[model samples]
Target chain A: MDDMTTKDVQEPYTKHLLHYFDGTSRYVLIKDEEVPFPEGKLIVSRTDLQGIITHCNQAFIEMSGYTEEELIGQPHYILRHPDMPKVAFKDAWDTVGSGVKWHGYVKNLRKDGRYYWVYATIILNIRDGKPVSCTSVRRKPSRTQVDACTALYAKLRQAEEE
Target chain B: MRYVMTVSPDFPPGQIAGWYIFNTWLQRQLGEHIHVELYSDFEAQRKAIREGQIDLIYANPFDAAMLVREEGFTAIAAPLSKPDEAVIAVAVDSPIQQVADLKPGTRIAATDDPDVNLISMIMLEPADLSAQNTQTQTVGTYILVAKQVLQGKADVGFFLKDAFAGLSGMIQRQLRVLVRSEIHVIRHVLLVGPRLRERHGDLWNLLSEMGENDKGRDALKNLGLQGWEMQTQEDTEFMIDLMDTLVN
Candidate 1:
């Protein structure tokens, strides 16, 4: 609450109208302005089996628009944009469960209801021969990658809604 | 209580069994149930570290900083006389004699070995080449990096100095070393996390005396190491500080 920055969003706010996998959807404003991902910096985070954030690096905190104290112990879907198709996370969980790494271009919503695109790679963390958690590192995706993901995600989102 | 020990993944395929032998020797000498878990890359290994899954680790110089500072891993020892080094090379026929001959748009093929890539990038600073300016291609292996340079697909290749030396003689003759990092202070170190803190002293003493016995000496040879060099906390902090400086 105190850590969140409620930036002034001029774009009219819109509701999901139909929602799933999103928990406690507080910020409903979807600004058309995109926050540019910083160069030469990596956003890294770790989550428990339930996808609750356990640790986050400074770069992640800066880009995510949420303070460190607020982010930890919260579900990672806090950054989930309604525009993101649920299938992306479903595919991630399905593949990562098999000890495989998953990589995709994603548009993550910031605390201010702004968005940024990243090339994210996630891997399963194992303990005593058992899977325990997940670690993800993300970097700025190229313009071409962002453009392609935008088109593909739009189609996927439309399909999910219909 | 079974502890999990992991090694850096950059070791040669020939050294896979060597690690197992070393692990077996460690368990026998320490009188503990220690299992070896092998991760194919740094991402997985780092994840395990963050998740508190790894108890003991043989880490690269780049990761040593994170392990000690971030994960509370205490440094114990390093392979005697083995310093991890990096080399940047070009094809023998290429006119690039020194690193300064490199240009901004030069295509550089490299592996994801963080220490090697970090030092190699610093070396390229003299030539005004950088990740922002250079066309960098990440190959799967050192040999593939060499292949990229030899086939003129990349103007330069970055490699682990040891891996480059391990290349076949025929291939070695085809490439020329542009520059090799001489930061001799950096080396792979064995570290124990908080869970294994109590056994650190016993483990260090055993490694120090490992060379006295034939079986222990044999295990060392299998891992391509001579002996163990005992490390103090000061030694570790200095090295990690150096690595932090270099990384920035």
Candidate 2:
């Protein structure tokens, strides 16, 4: 997967074993930093059916610290934060895959290894009478909402660990 | 104090700015005695219902049916969506003029709601298509699904006639309706929980009259609804059946 380029990643559903840096290293680096999502600005991205990054707006690219070229052919999960519970992603996939739009607060890992929180809505994109890809629109979340999600997510992640 | 809540799960929590504004206006119209709260979180509202904490609740057919069937909630009022039909739409310039023209693997998009999704499922049946044969995306909102169709991301999109009617001019002009379902019932139903019914007898009549006056009319306009009319057993039953069928 490391050697694969844009041409190779374009094929949908190319499952790659994601080795998270936080999980593998002897001493994990934690950048407990927060970047406020610009108010009223939408951060948008589109992924293929298999969750490969297809297109992203400037806000998404800039926030993630990845260039458009770097992001276009990569897996969308590259920006996934470890703090998020697997159940959240599972629910999100099941909901949208079953033809429901899903809304949730997501904490994302940036390219700089810092993290940010967003309230994201994931929807399915269909064309020519078939399911094509999914798009996610995200915005800055309120402090109160984030605090609640933070507590909820911690409980969820702990449950998974047990 | 009486508690009133509304569920629009498609919207994100804390992001329902306009909806919150409209609810606040409705609270004022309902007078100081009634407290109105709009919740976009399904789980939270469902929990409240299970605990018998909520009084009057507004919800989509699926949730309303669940509340009615299991929790002793009564459907009282519902919004009357003019031209209330399920519609399938495609880009105006797309060559696909009919449902039969759609090939296997064609992408169909609609809101994530099961009732709304069922419309597309039923429409695709004429072409001998099922869920497995087609790629379906559940969009978060009707306007987004319409936008997907117009942007060529989705070949087809499904939304109730009222949602299509509410589309922005930019979206409406870019897409054309491919087909429409027969008339359907109201999308959202207002229900009074047992606790509310026990305390507030005949509250339905008062709530149903919300659309009759000027302040309520202005609020409804802001909320993008036409009017509230009392629901019938037939209307509630039809919606409940649709919800059950989707579940089973």
Candidate 3:
């Protein structure tokens, strides 16, 4: 096992490691800063097999409040907020699963039970033959705007859980 | 030289009467030798301006405001037309009868253009009407929204009075205006390129000096103008104010 150094794990290079994933063949960098991601801003990552997180940057860990020890073995949904509707995530997965980038707003919960919003750009990672990991970035949301969104997410989550 | 003047598709295109006529009349009156081509849509017109493919333009007030503010274009004149207003509408039999009637959960078919419809909604009335519990689903356009309302697909819709006027009689009959906005000046402004300012000072002078009887009067009339009038930055501050208020 190649131990990836924190410096080596930093962006502008960590993305290259995705090529080492089993059956991984290609990667795409989804870029956008429009909605203010706040915790160092950019979300650069790679994945393998059914949209899994193969590599993420320090910014991702800080924004998500997850230690690398806990994040490595888990799917991204560990951060999913109870307030978020499963359908939104379903749609996001379905979209990227089809091998295209989808741009939209997402409501997520932090490790502390606090909620955050992100203007997300999700891309499909295709290996030589299959999907591996899915990655995302989240940022703070404007309080004034998120009230309506929060309410909507509550309803969506209710429907999903039902 | 020949110049193309791009206008919004909100109105008809081509060499029709009203504003375009006035613009043509003004161009000939300036007599520095110029031709004006008219484009009916703002997107196409804006592309022309961005590409430096056109030397002059007659843009919608919002588009003009952006050009003046962002691109440093100079405004030679703006039509005297009153600003276009919008109306939030619901089915005639719907329970929504007033602005206060809207709740947060209400599904409103609105355009994705935040600057125009969404910001305008906030500027016109800044309240958590949605707090009462309603949702706003942004649709592609007002026309699709109108169809949605008619087919009972949406609870409410927002539309410009001018645009709603042209909808089919069947759809028109199904809707009722719940609230109409305060009159806003959606003027058609004539602007010169920034690079042309010094070399075209004489042309601007000609424009500023031309009167109703000037040969350009026909073009001016086509463009829906009475005559050219000079305006300072202060003249357009209200638009900036509206934009700033919405953005903030």
Residue A30 lDDT (model 1): 70
What would the per-residue lDDT of candidate 2 be over residues A1-162, giving only the tens digit for each residue?
Answer: 233233322323222233442342121223567777653345777788888898787888878877999999887777777678888988998998987778888998666556789878787764435777877767556566788899999999899889
**TM-score between predicted and true chain B, model 2:** 0.79
Q: Which residues of candidate 3, in runs, are more than 4 Å off?
A: A1-162, B12-23, B32-47, B110-115, B123-145, B165-171, B183-188, B198-211, B214-221, B224-229
B10-112: candidate 1 lDDT, tens digit per residue: 8877999999999999999999999999998989999999999999999988999789878989989988998888888899999998765677799999987
Please write out the lDDT profile of model 3 over residues B1-248, one tens digit for every residue.
55545545455433356654555555555554345555544566677777876656665565755676667777666555545566677898998765545556667777644334632354223224432355666666578878778778777787766567767788889899776654344345567776556646666676666553546554555654456666555445434423332232
DockQ of every model listed?
0.01, 0.01, 0.01
Evaluated at residue A74, the lDDT of candidate 1 is: 89
- Local accuracy of candidate 2 as per-residue lDDT tens digits, B1-248: 65666554643333455566656765565553455555445676677778877777767666776787778887777776632357788998999987667777888887766555665565665454568888887766787898788878888998877677778787888888887765234367777777667544345555577677887677676666687777765457545643443342
Docking class of 3: incorrect
- Reference-based lDDT, residue B49, model 2: 76
> Across all candidates, what is each one's fraction of true contacts kept?
0.00, 0.00, 0.00
How far in Å is the alpha carbon of B157 misplaced in model 1? 0.6
Fraction of true interface contacts that also occur in model 2:
0.00
Which regions of candidate 2 deviate over 4 angstroms?
A1-162, B2-4, B10-36, B41-48, B51-53, B81-84, B199-202, B232-235, B242-248
Ranking by TM-score: 1, 2, 3
| Candidate 1 residue pairs in clash (backbone atoms < 3 Å) | none
Q: RMSD per prediction, one decimal?
A: 12.8, 20.9, 16.2
Ranking by DockQ: 1, 3, 2
- Provide TM-scores for the models: 0.61, 0.52, 0.48
